[model samples]
Target chain A: MKNLTIPEEELMLPGHTACLGCGATLAMRYALKALGKNTIVTIPACCWAVIPGVYPARTLEVPLLYTAFEVTGAAISGIKNALEATGNDDINVLGFAGDGGTADIGIQSLSGAVERGENVFYIMYDNEAYMNTGVQRSSSTPKGAWTTTTQVGKVRDWKKEKKKNMVEIMVAHNIPYAATASIAFPEDLIKKLEKGKNIKGPKFYHIYATCPTGWRISPSKTVEIARLAVESKVFPLYEVDHGVYNITYMPKKNVSVKEYMLPQGRFRHLTEDEIKEIQSEVDKDWNLLLEKEKWTQSLNKVQ
Target chain B: MKKMLTGNYASAYGAKVSKVKVVSAYPITPQTTIVEKIAEFIANGEFDGKYIRVESEHSAMASCIAAENTGVRTFTATSSHGLALMHEMLHWASGARLPIVMSVVNRSLGPPWSIWSDQQDTISQRDTGWMQIYTENNQEVLDSIIMAYRIAENEIVMLPAMVIEDAFILSHTMEPVDIPDQADVDEFLPDYNPKFKLDVSEPMGFGSLIMPEGPFMEFKYKGHESMNNALKIIDETDILFKKKFGRSYGGTVETYKLDNAKYALVMMGSTASTGKEVVDKMRDEGYEVGLLRIRSFRPFPKDKLRNYLSNMKSIGVFDRSYTFGYGGAVFSEVRNTMYGKNIPIKGYIGGLGGRDVTMNLIEKIFLDVVNMSEKGQDKDYEWVGLNGDKRWSQ
Candidate 1:
């Protein structure tokens, strides 16, 4: 309820070509509120590429560069360099791309940018599937999701592999800032973005944006489902700073993972046993993350 | 003031005098010296810019693209494999129209992994929408870079430019280059003024999504028109550069001793130097053989090339890069230009992957062209410098 006080200033204008109740659109709205007007966004080929509308008329109030699907990292690095060169260090260079762009196609350039310690913020809006290219399964797509490429039937099945651990990947790079945010929690998402903006060197924000179009979910229940994801530990809110883990928000009451999945038709084929298996997976991941936070804290104490 | 300098130092000196704001690069052979000099310049405080030492060629290109989009005059250098690695961002930089200038030390792409001189790398990127210029010597390398900014940043042609030079042949071989004074360069190239920038004061959208058909076509059409217009700007800028610096070489194609020549040899890159030597030697011996050096690759200078070759008895094309299934890359383009015309054309696939195109090789190529013109029997394609054993084996 406290997060409802986010500034109502319309940084992203209406009449843009986003689908009805697009969670990614809301994510952009809130992100701009935190990053403010002094941000330059570099977007690779993704859904946001279409959402921003056509040239001479875009939804964003900030300067944006639409780069190749694989070069968002490089594009943002270039923008940051340009900013610094012109004595405009106050501006933030934000790389906004979808999970497919970040976790798959754009990974090499992203890794290179981060490894070089580029002074910029990279935000991967994870809606799971490659929504722009007609719901293909990206590496970030959760296991057991029925995508166009990962169809479920006899002899063939949904994605068998678990979603990639991008946060851990960012941690491996020892970036200055890396965090997981959810559109369901505006306060937490804005807080992470604002904090990321202040830190020097490469920072990453993996925001869980619900995709009603791709995920086969009700547009009206976008935020509600996104909230259930975090509450159920299906997508936990956490941050990693210089290899130290910090769980940003703890759910007041733990809910069954089924409560999060049952609402989405994308997961309708899962049996009760399969749902339980997914729950166990989420629990195991959350516990491992908790251990990492505790271990990092203890290391701080020893130091 | 003009000083004779090698092409490699000219590239370095061009970046130096341009007061480039950011330099991001990873070193590869041939291109390593360019960035090395840039790093030294930064260390010596000759240029005040952020020198980002990135891990790979990909990051180097990406960093500079970001830097340039944010309204900085960013500079980067690479060659061969390094250039290939930056392939994706090459499209991004030009499509975003960032006006980023890069110096490509030309080297052959690898399968056998040779780090010798050739034009394959830069030639392979001709479709990336960047204005590409080939430099003959140090002066052209220096002057083209300064002029590249003018051409790329033009309101009509706001695309990136790649100033390419032969790898070790030019990059490592230093000649006495007359370094332009900072003041003179300052007068020549003003501070880079971006038309639309990522600024806080006035927020705007750039490189945003263009829908399925309409927006994509519009952007592509504009890109095509801009590149077409760049032909005139390239020549105009060359004229301005000559007036200011008192020197000019092939604005599009450099013609040497074609006055009364019946047969002409056409080539690009460092091999053109050898071609010129052979042309002069043939001229001394009263042979009607001349040389034409193609300086600009993009905007292909089709008209200029056609006009130059129309009256020639026979035109010989020497290409350093291949088109794989097709014949030589430059040879195909020349044939396309000569299509519907009566000009006789002969193609020689030589100097590929850094093979030395010596004066003797030039003489042999010229002889073939002359033989083709006299006998009316044109050889489809011939590989130069291969020994009899190797030639038979292939």
Candidate 2:
């Protein structure tokens, strides 16, 4: 166990409007600690858009720009340019979007900014589905997740597609920094973000945010469920720097995907066969990542 | 310190002189060279800025938008398909009111795709709240960018500006352009000082959602008024630019021998250069023909357009892009400008899909306008350079 001391200065204060034990709220709290006060955040149409509260009474301590669901990348980029034009280069320009906003609707602009290597940090809090619009299936929704759009019944239909690998897509642009972090692992999440601050060019952090309300789970189990996701290898914590891959946190005892899926009501309808299939898929992805890490290591040695 | 360059180089020079702190861009034809030159400048240490090699046109716009919001003088360039991909963000940049300057090399849209000279792509984005300025030549391309920053960063008009030039014709074609000295440009256009910006010390909300009919309308109305107010600033700044750089193109509207001329041709972008040549040749042939070059599109120059065309006996509008089913895009706008007026206006839809609008085509347009006015007849929106077999079979 690592000794992690949390920062004292809280940029995101309590008593603001957010669901109890909201993973995104906690994500914001930790993200703000790494970003500090010298940051301006642009948020698009997502749960965070509403969670920030209405004008005259907002929660976020940083300057926030709420843009349309599809234009967060463009808006944040504009803000970043405006900041630089005025000779203020120290402030961090952060874009906070949800899975739906980042992986689906905003993907074009996101890819554009990343390819351009815009000096900005984008944090996408993935709750798997479009939770703000009533748990519709987003591209980030993993296979076999039960959402309103991908319901389970006599039809036996669940999300059939795998979650879009946004980190890889970002890395394909040859972005300087990209990492996957989770709300359950605050220490790891904070460390990755702190490390990201030093890297130039576009930095993307994909945070696995748990949604108790949408997931139909107890609020108390949110963090536990998030941790189980990492431990089960469903959502591995990893970082990619200039195409070099490294797994940030390797789980000690590899837990079955069933153990992680069984606790969540979202995946409750999955049969044993389906669970096994998911486990195999996770193993395949893990092996692929391991190969990439090894290949990067060899390249570094040659260099 | 001084070099004769093309309009594209002038724009790059202007960005360099502005000491642009960041540049994020993607490659598209015509516009590709501008970014390529900048990349070279950055690599060679000719320009001091962080040049981001973005993945797509969307990201290029996003990166510049983000950089601009951070109070940096950021620059980017794109054209045609790239601009279409950036359509969604075009509105975002304007609505957010970030004064990010972008150079759009006007190229014909794809699918029967051709990368040639035309004003269709930029003209299509007229309603995106961006202050659009069309250039007749390379000099205007360079000067318009420097002027764009002034108009965009103005307290009233805190919207992004697009400096548009015809692809290949102006973007690729080389013409002598006086590259302004950095010190002269600095004295002419001071450092950008944003009225409102993203700052951590004084946290403020930006681009926040507004109820459809409430503050949204207020903000939109303000944007409209700002664009309207920009017309005067455009002229004022052009005057200042000339005083500083010793060059000017009569601001938003440039008239080529229009005084006492009974017939006139109106257009924008690089095609205006061809129109000017035609007008001169017609004058040499002892015909009373003139040319009106529309420099500003967003602040559409309605009054100036009306004032110039209202007195002319016959006015011909040459459009490079069609509005599909309707007449030419610019022709429609030109007609709309003269809706309640007594002037005889004829619309000629021509040079689409990057077709060349040569001096001979301009002469044909002028003749058509003259015949239409004399015969009191309106030809049902015709396409130039189409023979009987090539004309629509329908």
Candidate 3:
């Protein structure tokens, strides 16, 4: 992409406790670069909550307020208002949470924060399952994935429900900004985070962070798996700003969903029929997303 | 200006005079009108603040903690289930030492839901490290909200406070409440300007894991000491409030004719208002009975209670909410405080689940305590107004 430009400043300390090739860790690293030192981050219960280590030994250079599992959005709104009240309006407030904390247990508070039009940035690092809880099934777990709760035994159930569409769910609130990003594409992720920070009202970002420990993939292959997810259109790279849909990156040719799933042990047991079904579902989503962007652009043109 | 207001409106006016910077709350029974009145105040330009309409009680408390940490005064209100839902975060707010003030309209917990008055909702939150203040009437509700901020925000006592009132009983019942001047409240509370906040210029992280053996134990040690410190601050604030507004709730525990009485009945919240009425009625009939109303419950008023009970030969505790398999909460605290004093005490658990606690019921409890031949030292509690209780049944 013509010499990708990332800022030189490193906001994450080198001795953090995150696993090797951990996508959420990298996501936090890149996020701090975009947000810089003038940021206050509130983390709900997630991998990052523990990754920062104990009180006096935090890795983040910025101020962080660790909150209860479901209060990230509410905490962000509070921090933002607090800043305004105390005459520190220039600093940014960001809420960082895991998939279980965001798409599942935290959805109501998140929805309330956005509906109230609070000025804050919410980043949901989607690891698909409740990884920190030892890989239990969360609403963000993709279909045909094997989590502890979604065991592939007896009835052969492996998360039959589809992964919750958190981006669309957030957009339904008509917030100023909602975007889908991935750790594989740091430039796009960073750009979107910067854009979100610039927006005055509530902004949400759903970043596809790969979990090697939870998904039973090689730790080194975490970013590769994240890349495959975007290439296969299973986790698209897109942004919706002020009701305007825009797909920022489009792959030249879609690799099948099998190419995305085969390396991960969580999806290893899927049969050819199941792979085809997943492929069809991915194709359906891609087509709908394109149609939405086109219709939104045309509507803008007419108006 | 004196206006007739429910306990809910009194709470709102109290927050208004204090100039709370942020208010976040969710609507539940008995608490809905509190937030409604606050919203009305904010809409009419009476209170200039950021009002967040949170989804649930959990979010409500979460937002208040956040706002409070930012070094601004914050307020919220909730009822039975809402307070229960906020239980986990309530620890965080107090643990982080945020001076957030909340009003709990005390409704009974459910099986078959009832919105009427009971003390369980706030009593359930007693152990959450928050300074708990139970108000007896609309005026106390209004005054306590302001004094709660003054007491809680005192540098030595930077813990959260809850000004609790009974659902429907005080929350819905109307009375004449004196609305104080904003300038006087400003002199009492000042602006909530803390020394630290969530600022990038001076970065600080809260809710960090501190090992108990290390500073974590010290953190709790300080928290407990701060709760103890709040007792003096509460008293001083009460004194100053009297000088400014010409009304003072006898701090910690307000007493009614307890100096000469041989028997006393102890209670808190709106039930104490009923006890006051009954104590007056009993005294009219040449009975030397008294009423000891507990105002600040978390610090437990150990010294004040001992002083009040020192002369009394017997005392009865009227608990509107039971402690389940144990005696009443106030009764348990009383026994714990008077462990060696050997004051004959009887605890009557009644008015649970919003059952009416009439004046006759309270009189019966006092009479029973005065007539008893046994010395205090009972593990069992007397359930008042039970189906076949002869003392209260007739």
Candidate 4:
């Protein structure tokens, strides 16, 4: 069995401004562990833009460059290349942004960076909506979920579209490493981040972070809800290395998607038939992911 | 070396001699060959710069923004829809005070998708806080780009600049351009050393949010002050460049035979060349008319224009673009500038959608200027040549 121990370094200083039980906070905490003090994080306008407090009181131990809302990807590429030009090529340049920034406004620049094969790490902390701006629906927001933009009201509501497949999109770029992680699985997340550190090209991480305020869940259930998210297979943990898929953690016993949704007030209006329908969709996607891993492993064996 | 080259190639040569450190590019009509030449320069090891192949013009400008923030010289080029898409990032470039230089080939915007010459493409971006300058010839295009860097990167004036040339008229048409040697260019333009940047050890944040009544207004004031100072620096650089290279375009507004003439024709871009040809022909015919060409639009050169216009009895402002319900873009500006004066100033709108602004048409416009001056009758506005369509005349 592999050792699943995480690093003890706390690059995220305490006395910061993140909300209680914010999974994005934990996501940054662990991401800093993977990329240590020798890292520079370039962030777009999102929740993290304000989480570090105002100037003279910023909580980040490492340097942070806050850029325009849709420019984190292009900013990282420019930063990395400028560092290379200046003879400081050994540091890691990480791009951190939210789902709205990653999946919608920022995808063009992100596509440009990966297409150019820039040496940088892009992390999309997916809380599933535009949480910082009062919980609006984003492209990464799951279908049938209630948001400010997709409100559950008479004559309309709830996100009709499915969540955007960001990991698959990164994998389509033929990037060296693309992974899906969760705040529930820190050891697995850290392990994948460590694996990505050894890779030389562009790496992407789509981390499933739960927004208690956005999801209308209890603050105390942040970790528990995230764990249920994985066990329910709604948020699978996997990595693709050069088109080879690897399911990092396979749940021993699958939980019902209902168990995952019943506690969150965001989905309180979901009917029984609606829950069963979402269950079928989750199962179908999980089976497809399993087949991808199986087929990729078989191809590796053949080669 | 002196070589006959299109205006696009001249733009690329200007960037090469300026020792640009990073070039982010997206291909668009007329501007495509400019980026292609820069790429070829990079591939041939003649130029040492990072060539970023962006997906769209937005990323191209975004990449240049960050690259310039890192204390290095950056450049890019686009036209038409590509430039329209970069509108958002163009404000960011100037608001953050990154002195990025971009070449805007003046192509008409689409609906009918015509890739022809029109000044409206650049005129639409007039309020974006970028220093806009129009070039008359291939040589002036090359020189203005270098001058753009010198003026933009000046400590007092840290803003982005746009060098615009008419599409196909200059971009595709070849003319003799004197490409200066590296040593002369090196002596002229020094290395860019920014005062602040994204440094890990130093740890400074850029583009932070401030409240409405906060430092926002003051920051805007500083940018405005810097822009107002560009006019003086432009004059200084023009004198210096002339001393070194034997070519000088008399600061922002270039005048020809306005010494004792009572009537003058005013315009910008390559159209000024056509206008100047007719002015000289009239001078040889003893018509006593002069030409005044505006090189810089952002600074507007009100004082220089006022000094000259204060002398002329009648002036005709020529604009290739109209602003709908209002007068022509340049004509409106000139009229507003000459508002307090009682001179008979008429506006002639012509040469749109790549329509020919023929020598005969220019001669006729000047002839009308002479006739209008004699009767002291000034028509507020008129479309010069539109295939003589009489429906609008009614």
Highest lDDT: which candidate? Answer: 3
Model 2 error, position A221 (Å): 3.8
The CAPRI-style docking tier of model 3 reads medium
Candidate 4 lDDT tens digits, A35-151: 888888888889989888765567787777777789888988877776776677788889999999999999989988998899999999999999998899899999779999898
For residues A1-303, write the lDDT of model 1, one tens digit per residue: 354657677788887787887889988999999888777887888889988777668888877777778878877777776677667878888889999999998898889889989888899999999998899999999987999999988854888889999989989998889999999999889888888877889999999999998889879999999999999998999998777899999988768998888989889888899888888999999999999999998898888
- lDDT measured at residue A130 in model 4 versus the true structure, 0 to 100: 95
- Please give, for residues B1-394, the per-residue lDDT of candidate 4 as tens digits: 9999999999999999999988888999978999999989998999887888888888888878887877789899999899999898888898999889999999878778888888888888887889888999999999999999999999999989999999999998899999998999998999999988776676666666565776888889999999889889888889999999999998788988888788999988998888888988999999889999988888778888888887788889888877878678788888788888887888888888888888888888888778887797656878877876642221
User: Second chain TM-score per prediction?
Assistant: 0.95, 0.95, 0.97, 0.97
lDDT of 2 by residue, B155-196 (tens): 877889999887777777777777777888888878876766
Give the worst 10-residue stretch by lDDT in candidate 1 chain A: A1-10
lDDT of 3 by residue, A125-231 (tens): 99999888799999999999999999999889888888999989988999999999889999998899888867899989999999999999999899899999999
- In order, how many clashes per candidate? 12, 44, 0, 0
TM for every model, in the order presented, reads: 0.94, 0.88, 0.96, 0.95
Candidates' lDDT values, in order? 0.84, 0.82, 0.89, 0.88
- Model 3, B52-133: lDDT tens digits are 8998999999999988887789999999999999999999999999999999899999878888788888888899999999
**lDDT of each residue in A195-291, candidate 2, tens digit only:** 8889888899999999998888889999999999999889999999878898989988768999998878999998899989999999999999989
Candidate 2 segments whose C-alpha is farther than 4 A from its true place? A1-4, A15-21, A65-93, A101-122, A164-180, A195-204, A227-259, A279-303, B1-4, B388-394
Q: How would the candidate models be sorted by DockQ, starting from the highest?
A: 3, 1, 4, 2
Error of 4 at B340 (Å): 1.6
**Which candidate wins on DockQ?**
3
Q: What is the lDDT of residue B241 in candidate 3?
A: 89
